[model samples]
Target: MKASFAKFVILFTVLAVAGFSFYFLSSREEPSSLCPQARTTVSAPEKDARMKNILAPTEENIQAGKALFNSQAQPIPCSICHGFKGDSIGVIFQWIKPYARNFTCFQTMKDISDGQMFWVIRNGSHGTRMQAYKKLEDEQIWQLVLYLRSFSE
Candidate 1:
């Protein structure tokens, strides 16, 4: 009986520890890092018709963006690369070159215009793991841009 009781106690302890570990790790809101200086002044192509944020930074739009970032993005989800919190340290961070874009870096985001962000989201960066989210709708992309910008703010 004593041996059985000891085993039960050990199992309970292990289960408790695992449960807490999962809760703490998953509950983390965002990761903070010192971002490198970037050329934030990327200009939007004049010919691109959707060069502005049509949707306001309302809760609904931001929520929609969050949803898209988490699951709805085509090719691959944004959270897989940019992180669920837009912190750049995503699940595939090790495999990506030059690292993912850290949307939380206010210094870099400060100079990047809404139009520039829209262009990047639609066209993707040329030399990075960021592929063009061409499958996403224009409005959906705009909502995502807004959600990403919130990371810096």
Candidate 2:
């Protein structure tokens, strides 16, 4: 009986450790180190030539941007690919190659300039499924940028 009890305790301890390990590893969010992301978009000079967001990140602008990101934008909403929380884990994220840009990752977002983001939003990226928001005025795009920035903040 003593030997059987010891074996049972050992088995329980191993199982408990394994269970806890799996839970913690799986539940944790992806690290910010998944950054310095590569892009095959406009030329460096062209991206640099683009202007940065002119609109400040005021509550009103951010709210407008949130609207666009959630559902108001044309073609499709940003949340469809970038996730509602900007985590890049949207419903269709699994289907997109290279995955979507994770705005929540400051390590990645910090490297992307506002002008670069503006150019991408206006012209779209070459290799990605991002579409050009020609219908959206420059100010609207800037608003969206403000909202995207809020995720990292």
Candidate 3:
């Protein structure tokens, strides 16, 4: 009878640990995998427009973009909403509706042209929380585009 009681106690303890682990993991906020996102921000002409990034994706340029994205950009940093990994699960992800674009998603990023991204970065998305980064120069915006593209690759 003592052996059976001991076995029961061990089984109960293991089950309780497993249950707590599952609960803790599930409660944490995770990034949503919204691939192939249907973007309707830019008009047909704007979406298809081809604008070349004059600045090459050199290590320096990418680092500059990273800095801007993380904390240097005016108004607010992109990482506040886009997340450090560009996964769209930012610090304020729970409060945002329609979530920020997940740059890590190749299916969605592939459809977005450089020009489209440039336009959005300069002008901001009409319906989204993304604000116009007017302070960023065209070259800086291009650098940002290059850095954003790296998330998918």
Candidate 4:
């Protein structure tokens, strides 16, 4: 009887260890670069024919956009949802069902035009965590667009 009890205990211990090992191994970090980018069927509203990027993609403009994306000055910094790397793996994405946009994916971003992106930024995307940056000037949004374009490049 003792031998049977000892065998049962040993089997249980082995099973528990194997279960834990599998769980931990599967939980390893998944880089955002490898994750699938956000795929949206929703069409961005058309932009005004005259609307265009007022700020050139200069070093200063890019820096300003980067700062805004990382800072909480206005619109609470895009990094909160888009991630610091613009890979859309922000901390807030955990609660968001669809997740945020992964800008690194060229396939998804190729279809998005500058004007469409600008409109989305200025007027938040529907059914997503994105919020409208009505407080930010158009030029500031354009600067952010310029910064976002770099992620795919």
Best by TM-score: 3
Global CA lDDT computed for model 1: 0.80
Better of 1 and 2 by lDDT: 2
Q: What is residue 89's positional error in candidate 3, in angstroms?
A: 0.7
Candidate 4 on 74-134: residue-level lDDT in tens? 8488898788998876866555656777777787887777887788777777887777788
Q: Any idea what lDDT model 3 has?
A: 0.84
TM-score for all models, in order of appearance:
0.71, 0.72, 0.76, 0.72
Candidate 4, which segments miss by more than 4 Å at Cα? Answer: 1-38, 48-51
Of the two candidates 1 and 3, the one with more favorable lDDT, higher being better, is: 3
Writing each residue's lDDT as its tens digit, candidate 3 over 4-93 gives 999999999999999988876675554544666556665426434577788889999999999999999898999999999998878877
- Full candidate order by lDDT, most accurate first: 3, 2, 1, 4
> Which window of 10 residues has the lowest lDDT sum in candidate 1?
33-42
Relative to the true structure, how large is the alpha-carbon lDDT of every model? 0.80, 0.82, 0.84, 0.76
Determine the C-alpha RMSD for candidate 4 after optimal superposition of all C-alphas.
6.6
**Ten-residue segment with the worst summed lDDT in candidate 2?**
28-37
RMSD of each: 7.1, 8.3, 7.8, 6.6
- In candidate 4, how many clashes are counted? 0
Candidate 4 structure, TM-score to reference: 0.72
Best by lDDT: 3
Candidate 3, position 149, lDDT: 97
Clashing pairs in 2: none
